[model samples]
Each structure stands twice: as C-alpha cells, then as structure tokens.
Target: MNINFNSEDAGQIVIGAFALSVPIAFSEESWHLAQTLPLGNMALVVLLSLGFIALFAYQSVFQANVMRRIGVFWLRVAIAYLLTLAVVSVVLIALDKWPMLHQPILALKRTLLIAMPASMGAIIVDSFDKE
Candidate 1:
C-alpha cells in the first residue's frame, strides 16, 4: 500500500479540504470559538486533528502495510492536515474572517479548529479514489 504523493493526489486533497472548510470559515461560531477557546484547548484541537488524519490515512491510504511504509503514511497525513489548514486560511482571508494582522494566534486557532473537519473531508475524499 505505497500511495504515491503525486500532483493529482495533491489536487484532490486541496479540493476536498476546501469543499468542507469554506462554509465553516464563514460561520460566526467558528470565529467566536477561535477568539474565546483557551490556548490549551486550541492546542488540543490541533493535536486531535492530526491524530484523526493519521488514523484515516492509515485505514484508507496505507491499509495493511502502514508500518512498512510509515514514511509515506505520515507524509500523506501531514499533507492532508496542512492542505486543510491552507485552504481554510485562504477562505477565511477571502471572506475577511481572518484577523491575522490584529490577532495572529486567534487567526491560526480559527483555521486549526475548522481544519479538523476539513481534514476529515480531505481524507475521505482521497479514500474515494481507492474504491
């Protein structure tokens, strides 16, 4: 189960991540969560998101040979999470939802919070190609 990290794969992850991230980015609740969630809780959200990405990637992309191809497995997981964050940031910025200039950490936290579900969407969409 050596999944190649090709350009097309990258494109699909971006598309999938963006599809889910956009609506959340526009949500008032998401913005408030970013502003009010404690720093420790925000950190937990990031860690949990990465964990979900790793689990989903292992089950869908790497399958049985996950440990054998651990590098590729982690790489896919990282890409999916990073792409989710990137797409979320772009959408937030476009919507004037990102307050990076005024509050950088809040902006980042908001993106990470939204990236959780976006990454799930990305992993699921990427898995669809397997079937």
Candidate 2:
C-alpha cells in the first residue's frame, strides 16, 4: 500500500518522540546556556527538534529513493554522513567550538548518536496507519 507521507505530520511525530530526552537535553543545554541566554530550555528543545527532523527528513528521502542493494544502502548512508558532517562542521565553526574528531572512533560515535534518533523517528512515522 502506498502511503502519502506528509512532511508536516512527520515533523510532529519527531517532536512527540522527543519525550524521554527532553529532561536530559533540557538540563544539559540549560546548564550550557545559563552562561548565555534567556529561554534556554525552550531554545534547546526547539533546536534539538529541528535538528532531529532535518536528519530524519534527509535519511527518509535517501532511504526511500536509493537502490535497495546492501552496497548501495551503505553508499547512501555514507553520503548522508558526509553531508551531516559538513553541515555540523560549519555550525560548530560558526559557534567557535572545534574539537578533534579526526579519528574514525570519535567520528563514527558522533554520527551514530545523531543518526539513531532520526532513524527511529522516521521508522515511527512511516509505520503509523493513516486510514
């Protein structure tokens, strides 16, 4: 059965999935932002939600259109990783925080952490019945 996926619904699903992590991100980001701005928790949640949705949207589109072969899937994932890295790198640079992620271990860890939630969110959205 073909599903007419609305991007708007997907975004709402993403934010709803932010449940268990809200407190964690809120506490951590609040601590970080205490040194910076007002509305820190709200801002942190908004940023996290947007980032989560963007990654989900990217992965969903790629995973849907890319060839289903195992090798092709990995290649698609690698391209997504590079794109995410470039986007994140520019943001980190703009924010003036640079660390050593030159090694595969650290880089892979970072990518997987960012990717897992988005992957889960996409799965959740796609599996929902819309009759």
Candidate 3:
C-alpha cells in the first residue's frame, strides 16, 4: 500500500507521532513490549541519536537538491542555509519543546526529543526540495 508520508499533512504526522511516542515511551505501559517507547528523559538519548542520523541523512539529501538548484551561487547557498536554520531552529525546534533539548544532553530520550524533530523537519524540507 502507498503511504502519503510526504504530503502537507506530513508535519501533522510527525507531530502526532511525537505526541504519541512521548507518553507511551516513558510510561510503564511500554514495558509490556520493549524496554523503551521513545520518550521520557532516558529515552530522549535514543531520540537524539536517531535525530542525528536523521539530520545527516536530511542534510546529505538536501545539499544534493540545493546544489542542483544553485550550486555556483553563494547567495542561494546563504539563503538556503539561513532558511534551513530558520525552519529547523525557529519553526519546529523553537516552537514547542526546545526547552527539552536545551536541557543537558546527559540522557538518551531527551536528546531524541530535540534531535528527532530536527531531523524530521529537515527530512521534510529535503523531500520538498526540487528533484
């Protein structure tokens, strides 16, 4: 079956996924299956790790598309960079749960809380980039 994970509603999908993940991950109910759900302070680290992986993937994909658009133009590069920072930093990261990421990356779950959203957003942009 086809999945529309790349539509305008995809943002809502990511947000909804995060919302569901947070409570289930930290709660004891998750213990019925795996040891973690994907939230809570401890689980945050894993989220961070996943987020980094997602970021790297998104950047690599994004750069390729950006290069295709205006590889030789520094102006485009700067604009893309600033836009990316603006989108990931302000729109998504800074909106709801940035405080959670600002917390010391001392744990797993907390890290994911910060990183996953970053990665997911980046990936979304990458997907939207002209191919």
Q: Which candidate number maximizes TM-score?
A: 1
For candidate 3, lDDT tens digit of each residue in 1-131? 11222344344334533543444335433322232443364455544545543444335444434344344333322333333333333333333433334542322233333344444444444344334
What does candidate 2's lDDT look like per residue over 14-70, in tens digits?
443343223323343433443334445445543564555444534554434434444
Model 1: per-residue Cα lDDT over 2-118, one tens digit each: 398887788889988988998888789989988899989988998998998888877777775676678878888888888888899999999998899998998898888999899
lDDT computed for candidate 1: 0.85
Whole-model lDDT values for every prediction: 0.85, 0.40, 0.38
Cα TM-score per model: 0.94, 0.32, 0.26
- Residue clash pairs of candidate 1: none
Candidate 1, 64: how far from true, in Å? Answer: 3.0
Of the candidates shown, which would achieve the greatest lDDT relative to the real structure?
1
Backbone clashes, candidate 2: 0
Candidate 1: deviation at residue 42, Å?
0.8
The reply for model 2, stretches above 4 Å from the true place, is 1-68, 99-131
Model 3 Cα RMSD, 1 decimal:
10.1
